[model samples]
Target: MIITSAKLFEEILAILKDEDNIFVIGCNVCAAKLRTGGEPEVLEMCRRLEESGKHVVGWTLPTAACSIRSFESLVEKNEKINEAFCILVMGCGSGVSSVANVAEVPVYGSNDTLSLGGSSGGKLLSEQCVMCGNCTIGEFGGLCPKAQCPKGLLNGPCGGAVDGKCEVARVNDCVWTLIYERLKKIKRLDLLYVIHAPQEHGFK
Candidate 1:
């Protein structure tokens, strides 16, 4: 899931200082699950924006604002969007981009997406994938070194792990140590010897 956190109220207010009429939009999928941009969040934001002296034109919550087809239908039904001089998107960056793609008015994001993460325990998620485009989880028994390792080491441990704990984050287990144990468990320890190419980032 896409993990995100709501921007500070002061930061949001500062961004919208000169703006007046605002149409609020939220996501009902990942952002909703993360509580960054859900129905309650949208309502709270609308109330807060109004309290801050901005005229909130209207608000809509689309189930997965990242889905182009689905969001278009939501947009079609929300006529209040036309009255907005600007849009405040209470979702991830992708959601903001999706709104911007269809919206003529200036669009803004109210949250910052952290990482591609998941949660087993309620409301507690951790980064599992760095979204590097080329996934190599199969080699490391499904554990991503780039995501878990503080140094983003792809090959193996940096000889910094002590007693299975990471040198960088002492509280966390060394990702390579975890990978080694997991690979050993699956009888695929041979994969560790193989060299991985450097990551090709989308941005410089």
Candidate 2:
């Protein structure tokens, strides 16, 4: 899931400073899971806008605000959206961009997209992937050093690793240590000798 956090109230107010009639759009998938751009959030935003003396024309919770097709469909069905001078999207960056691409009025985001993460527990989000366009977990026993390691080391732990903990972030376990333990447990230590070429920096 794409993790997100609501933008500061003051920041949102500044963005809508010139706009009186506002329409809100929220995502029902990732953002909803994060509780940043869900139905309740949209309603709360409406209340806040009304409190600020701005007229909220309407609000919608689309199935997937990041999906252009879903957003376009919602816009087609909601003619009342046209009454608003601008739109406030309470989803990720992709969702905000999707709305801006198809909306005639100006569109602004009310949330800041953080990372590709999974729900750890409650409101805690754990980042799981960096989308590096390469998959090397098969050889590393499913632990991604690129994402887990602060240095994005692919081969092994940096010299700074201490006592099975990452040097960059002492609170986190050293990804290379985890990788070595897993490989040893599975009798795949031989794979460690195989050196990988540097990742291609260009587009995949």
The global Cα lDDT (0 to 1) of model 1 is 0.88
lDDT, candidate 1, 1-204, per-residue tens = 899999998899999999989999989998898889999999999999999999999998887878756435755868787899999998889989988888778989999989888877665657798777778789999999989999888887999999999999999899999999999999999999999877767411
After superposition, candidate 2 runs with Cα above 4 Å error: 70-72, 120-125, 185-187, 202-204
Every model's Cα RMSD, please? 2.4, 2.5
Q: What lDDT does each candidate get?
A: 0.88, 0.84
Predicted structure with the largest TM-score when compared to the true one: 1
Error of 2 at 1 (Å): 1.0
Question: What's model 1's TM-score?
Answer: 0.89
Clashes of each: 0, 0
List residue ranges in candidate 1 displaced over 4 A. Answer: 70-72, 121-123, 197-204
